[model samples]
Target chain A: MAMSDLYREHILDHYENPRHHGTLADADFSHEESNPLCGDHVRIDVKLSEDKTRIADAAFSGEGCIISQAATSMLLESVMGWRIDDVEQLDPQHVLSLIGVPLTANRVKCALLGLKVLKTGIKLWKLQQMQHSA
Target chain B: MHTQREFFDVHAVRRDFPILQQRVNGKPLVFLDSAASSQKPLPVLEAMERVYREAYANVHRGVYALSEAATAAYDEARAKIARFIGAPAVENIVFTRNATEALNLLAYAYARAFLREGDEILLTELEHHANFVPWMVLARERNVTLKFIPLTPEGLLDLDAFERLLTERTRIVTFAHVSNVLGTITDPAPIIARAHAAGAIVIVDGSQSVPHMPVNVQAMDCDFLVFSGHKMLGPTGIGVLYGKRALLEAMPPFLTGGDMISYVGFDDVRWNDVPLKFEAGTPAFVEAIGLGAAVDYLSALGMDAVRAHEAQLTAYALERLSEVSGVRIYGPQDPQRRGGVIAFTVNRIHPHDLASLLDQHGIAIRAGHHCAQPLHQRLGVNATARASFYIYTEPSEIDALAEGIEHAKRALRIS
Candidate 1:
């Protein structure tokens, strides 16, 4: 019943001043998604390494609840130096734990919207690369 | 205003709703979401149970004792609802799944059949999706133009704009009796008269209004009125689509199957009477009986008093919520011009976050676009947190809501 359980200090800090929050012009992969229920929108633009295996830089641009905006900010920080394979393996549970809150059944979607956009963007990027190499 | 406080025993009324007597998240359950779906009273719950246990049978076909009793109960339920809305006759009431289905029926059967090409269907910017989408679909299919009566900056419908929109090409005029998000109680008298003068049929979406106030279709003089049962303390899966007897008679059947036709042949068919023709297949008999009980419950309490109670609560909520910093409320400032629904936003606190924090204290409120995306677009807010009230809601709950907003601000670390 603690209010702090859902809106912790770290979440609000990241939400107030998000890290790496803007669209990328030199982006290799980009995707935008919105939660149909609450209309919380998030877009993730990722730049890849020259070798095309790791995420060199990541940025996000959108407006939403603290769980979503802060989640995207924290997600960008975590995935910047990650391999594409590791980013692809990021699941909903990992995103929820990163949010550091006990989200209810309904608010889980708000917390994971950024991760969903990133995973989808990476998947689409991998598909395009497969077609090019073929 | 002080005399209105004695209208009802809110504590006694709260006891009648058994679902409200429970605890959630280690706190007493504070239900502020009555506009979504009201909790049922004991009489309403027992009414449906009595039907299933005692008079369980298919209506209209069997001549046995059980079937006869079931048929009588179902018929009486229809009559009670017909009386509840001040319909001219029972034949005017057509049962549907919910308000959405009833509106779909009107759009498909009435508008599609009567209106011709290049006609206009005038709607407002404050409509819920149920009232807005069906007409849009009908307009697209029938090659009719669609126009909107825009809203003022304060969220009232622009009556001047509405008059200008009511040209000879306007074939139908429809709007919500009370906006679900903004809670604006629009006066339909002028609009109804103007539409009728232009020879256009007027349909009123009373899903929000009928549950909170006394509505007289004859007084409103609209051609058709639509509302749902679940939002008004009845069970789900039952609603009423009330039209004038003549209009329903002229309209063709929207759905076709068993119980809707008098006789059938491979080459030709004979449809049943006005209301039954629109109602296809087996109806929700138990739910209808439950709705009848809901009408009885509301009638015993009196609709005027029910409305007064909500007005008092809304005024209190508006006053109390204003005390909380950064809480911006939508809709008219006058309590007389609105319902118990309040859609609001807190500065730097997303509705989802506020709603989540409130749930910890066992306060339930809706946080979303509320099925009115276009209205939200017009209001320029992605989402809002809505707290709606009914008879059981009290001024104490309003205090809790304000305190909850403060708690949310503290939790979010906002100064």
Candidate 2:
């Protein structure tokens, strides 16, 4: 594939001007993950609605390749107002589609790093809640 | 003074490497990733093929002619490697899978056998993971302390800091001869001398230096030296760990099963001699033979000429790469103090992105930490793209790399 295809205009735009590219001070849950191979890092913070059933807002911060940083920006933008349940159900294919390009095996990790951080944080937060209620 | 151009013709030498003739992405291949692994020359490849075709058999076993031939070739390879590195004897060279495995062997057999709690292992920030991780594991297991010799702002190891770090508790001093990322060449002679005075055994990771320059283990007086075959125009699956005679004899075997044992009884077994004591199972005899041929090729070219050629290329590369805007080259600016490897970052472009863009032009480089994360952490950068040179590398490839960086900058809309 051409280099341009991988770094498309939208991808470059998201990289240059990332959306939701900061942390929320009162985030309900936050988690960070890194690709050890390339040292690409992504930390995701989520704020739930008052009822605590929907993602009212989300933000991501990290340093990495264009695909990683851009994909994280796009991911955070799309998951705004998403139900907590639906966000939990978010799969890798959805993230790949969001990327809108075929990624090599190495790059798939970069493109999906945000989703991993988001899902892992929610899962850990849910476990904490269960422990507290019990 | 003889010039490299007068003595060594890079174009003629390039013909020895078959892979260099290929076209990738519709452009001539500009392989600048020799620091990762070098391309095999024809002599090395032919030697390996000839061995498999003519004398294919398990070594040190059968009494048949084929086995004997295989054993002879393998033994000769060890001798050639021993001579290549100025080792005292052939018994000092132990074959392992690669440089990583060789380091692990030393960690398990030497450090685990000798070190005690609170014993210090002085390493540098410039080590590759192969040199770093094994010792780190040993520190965890043996309750040892790992101290690092810091790097100067220019990326050279601070010898004064090294002197201060060496204490009575320092049991081992291990470091890379050349930094894979920064291209800094640490002179082993003084370090070895000081480490010896401090009662620390020195292990030199010569993976990057051995291929690009002349390295004499005996002259350096390092306790152990480790290097891989693939990085020196040889086949993979072969590496060498050259240790002092007494040390190799003192250390226990790291891996044990076959060949390494002198005899096996129902309840007891006796270990073999020093070199074979370390080499277990069916070894990579063919690869070793190929490595022998690689040594022959390099010797024929003369290592002095090889070093001169790379020095010239490194100087030219540093000059050309500096001309490009937003390019920040790492390591010593002077090529005399470093290897042929050049690691740099361009503007705000991520190394992976830069590598991908360069790949489109058929220019291969290493991106990311290059397995030197601690050094990168010290540099305060996540990653840098690296371009390394070899005997066959040309000045035009460096020109291509400089041009390719411009193309990458333009594509990413970086002004």
Candidate 3:
């Protein structure tokens, strides 16, 4: 039972003190998702650029397992300056690689919770944009 | 059959479950999740296999030799289960898919048939979704109101609030005999007496209580009680709903099909007797036979001895788990009021993480809300890790759980 295979030092560091782990007071777009079986919740709030093409700032707030929370913090760090389209292309495998561990089938949902929130937030942001134009 | 002396012996009991001998994650398997679903003993498995191999046929409709043999086997199982639970007669026991289906049957046939608008249904905060949801549906459809007995901070039922909630309008009161998550063994005698005095019928979800304790439906004086076979070392897809025969006789059939009918006309029909009227189709006779074997195994061990074994194990687990810094236990701390199940949360370690870590040590435990979301909400925690004991569980497993928690804290870099 090599615990290091799952909880490496960097993963623990991020889990102990998550980065950008707070709610944006006035976010342009936000989304929340939860793993009902494990009760792992993840919410992402993003401030889009004026041109609406790039993410100007992103923050997250939720309580979950170390893998979920740390992966969320890492995910928040990776998408700060990315184009909305590239962020949308992020998939479960990409999140797996970001966490750098082989999660069992059950725990895959925990590692991917953050990415789900981000993708959902992007869709909501686009929806809000459409409503604003109208 | 296990010898009476060997019955209380944990080592001998462990040998009965073949699954316990295997290794998981390079460590000896430590099964601590019996409360979720118990592992089958050799006898239970052999009994089901015997039925399928030798006496396989649909029950009641067949008149041939094999069919009669099958029917006899199935009927005998019902009688055994009835005697095991101290029901008045075999006619009072109805077989359903599982305890969930059993609860749904009572809700539809009994509660839906009898209750009316402005009536009230009282439930507790600790009900599993199976027990809680059906009544909620009944309440909505019949224009009735549903009230809850608030949970005390100690994770026991608030009996004071329960008294206040019971009114003349209360037609039914349903709750768990033992909470699946809290492991709190609620004494239902008071509740049953009070509900009966208030003209309300009582339904006990004995899914948790029936497996670990000696249950006598007549002595309890409840109108109905339900439990699943899978949780008691039998096969899945089989459960028992024990009701007073008169109540079962009065309620309309929940499901209508080939087997449950006594006679039929083009537009009108005559249903079967007490239990069969509720059992609609070809019931799981094979699984029911398996459940009978499970009952035999438990009876041979003696329920009083089983209860004592779990009490000893639970006390040891509580004492051992408390030694782990920052581990907060749920339910009554006193072993007298709790069963073998222990639900706890370690500081800075989510239950999911802790469960996974324990898995690495070949220790199986349950994490999350355990299908009691309302209870979790009331407890103000998203989830908690649970380690439950069975006859096969030993004190050494609790030590493994404690070590697993320490290892998890270290891996997570928590103090």
Candidate 4:
């Protein structure tokens, strides 16, 4: 893999001075994901519409190495205002590919840390929506 | 050091390790993950092969020729290991799957015996999870407090904090003889002295140190020292836990099973002696024999020479990897007290990314927390990439690793 591909300038910028890195007060969905092996952690808070159909806002909070923090920040920017279905729609490989380089199998989980929180939040949203409909 | 003996060629040593000859990204493999598990040597391989091909049978229970031969081989292996660590008898040696299991054995048998509510266990922040987790569980289960000796800024264990932490409540002291991540060699003698004065038993995690240097359990004065065969050019599924004879004789048998029983009756069955009491069911006889052969191989090369060769490679790699612009090494700058392990972060590249690009150049390294989460947390990074050396590792391999890291950084342009 090219070093350039792994360290996109945008990724490093986000890691150095992260964007939207705090709790969203109006958040309806928040999920904490941790990579136990590496100790990477992220608490992703999404401000969802009451109907659970849309993401109104997104923010992240946690401590980790540069890539992990960068990835979470990029995720917040990428997912805001996107439909809940978009997050639920992502495959593991697509999430990995977004990092721009292929990953070794063990490190693949590190790349998926943010995607896991997004999926967990989506699952919670769907469950709440089912309960509301019932 | 003896330099008169015929020097072993790097290519010849590479031939002994079949994995080194294999292709990676269309290049000959450059393995740097020996800290995880060293590649097996021919003698170690042949010893296991002979055990299986010539004499394969259950140990201790069987009375026939094959069983007796296998049992004798296994017992002989124990004797060699006891001598290897300067222990007085084979009774002090209990076999386990790996260093982790050996540590858990002590946790179940010894730690459970004395630890109770309000007591404290002293451990160093440099412990691998294998050493740290077992004691943590004991602390939580018995309501015992677990404390750590904080690390210096250079990543060595802080001797001052260690001295201050010793008190009447402390029952046990455990720490790594060598940090698997930091590559820092720790001197446990003073801590052992203090713990002994406080009436605390000490456990030394020798998983890394035993492979790189000579380990004399008697000289170290540790109650228990655990090491893995896989990290020493021997097979997996076999390891050694050297406990003091009196200590082993006193502790309860952890796992109760067939081989561990003295005899069985409808109402009562007594446990066997020290090593047998702890060894339950069929042991890894082949692996044990292989480990004995590994001891012989390392002995033939001499541990002092192995230590010297590894130290040279480490210093060279550290110097070259640091040459990369914006690269940061987390451990000590001095090579004198450190082992061959080197952990670092590149300009702005993730360790996983560095590992992948290194793979393209047939260079292999370990990435992530390396199973020492607390150390990583203390260092304020989630993960770091590591390169560790062994007897078979060469200066050329270190150069390849440096070139690969530089290429990886330049390709990504993280700076």
- Cα-based TM-score, every candidate: 0.96, 0.97, 0.96, 0.90
Restricted to chain B, the TM-score per model reads 0.98, 0.98, 0.97, 0.97
TM-score of 1: 0.96
State the lDDT of candidate 2 residue by residue for A1-134, as single tens digits. Answer: 77799889999999999999999999999999999879999999899999998899988998999999999999888888988888888988888998898887888988999898998888898999999999
Candidate 2: the clashing residue pairs are: none
Give the worst 10-residue stretch by lDDT in candidate 4 chain B. B1-10
Q: For residues B210-290, could you state the per-residue lDDT of candidate 2 as single tens digits? A: 887889998999999999999999989999999999999999999999999999999999999989999999999999999
Candidate 3's residue-wise lDDT over B109-222, tens digit each? 888889989999999999999988898888888899999999888889999999999999999999999888889999988899999999999999999989999999888899
lDDT of 1 by residue, A29-132 (tens): 89999999999999989999999899999899988888889988998887887898998897778877788767778788888899999989999999998999
Please tell me what DockQ candidate 2 reaches: 0.78
- The lDDT for every candidate, in the order shown, is 0.91, 0.92, 0.90, 0.84
* Stretch of 10 with least lDDT, candidate 3 chain B: B1-10
lDDT of 4 by residue, B305-389 (tens): 7887787777777788787787789888788788999999886676876787788788889888999988887997778999999
**DockQ scores of the candidates:** 0.81, 0.78, 0.78, 0.42
lDDT of 1 by residue, B1-415 (tens): 1233757888888899999999888888999998899999999999999988999999988999999999999999999999998998999999999999999999999988999999999999989899988988887888898899999988899999998889999889999999999999999888899899998989999999999999999999999999999999999999999999999999999999999999999999999998899989999988999999999999998999999999989988888898888999999999999999999999988898889889999999999999998999998999999999999997888888898888878777776
Reference contacts reproduced by model 1: 1.00
